[model samples]
Target: MPALKINVHFGGGAELLFDKIKKREVELPAVDKYLPECEKKGWTIRELLVWIKENLLRERPELFLQGESVRPGILVLINDTDWELYGELDYELQPSDTITFISTLHGG
Candidate 1:
């Protein structure tokens, strides 16, 4: 199987989520290997918002959500395009595809 590069960025306090995934507490794999991670994480494209809930808003109920209550500011991209635009996590990917996640903003 091809290796997938997962990137993550936290708008303000989202590094925690990234760290969790990096440490393997949040399991993910290459495109071909995605199903197992999704199943293990109890995730689906519709339920992808959990990544934000478990990592962000739950901690700060006072947080203001953007236009959509989503998985923080972390933008998940397959190669370059936003994963959300492609098909979210359900986006069909092949081996050798790269996945990146990044935050839109950060603290001063």
Candidate 2:
């Protein structure tokens, strides 16, 4: 299966954790269409974070991740909307989704 493509934006110093690159278009890699959430739901935010850490993260992961979730104070938005309004890490990914991460801990 082809990788799932999505847009990622980092802001509020979150870009610093990603080598200062603020925007990225990433193909979530896998031979199978990753559907970790109830099969048809496709990749969840939880899985995406793991993918980001292993593939996109450039520096200290501690600043971006805490256990399995994004560290506290880091806000996650899916398609310009808050993840909390959805199901957070359990939220399934859709094609062409725009996921953004903003670090409240930086430049506050």
Kindly report which residue stretches of model 2 are placed more than 4 angstroms away from their true locations once superposed. Answer: 31-41
**Best of the candidates, TM-score:** 2
Best by lDDT: 2
Tens digits of per-residue lDDT, candidate 1, 1-108, equal: 444333333434444444434322233344235444444332343333444455433354323244344446556666677776877756544434554545565676
Model 1, C-alpha of 79: deviation from truth (Å)? 1.5
Query: What is the C-alpha local distance difference test score of each model?
Result: 0.46, 0.86
TM-score list, all predictions? 0.39, 0.86
Residues 1-108, model 2: lDDT tens digits: 457888999999999989899998988765245543434436779988988898889999999999999999999999999999989998978879999999999552
lDDT for predicted candidate 1 compared with the true structure: 0.46
lDDT of 2 at 20: 96
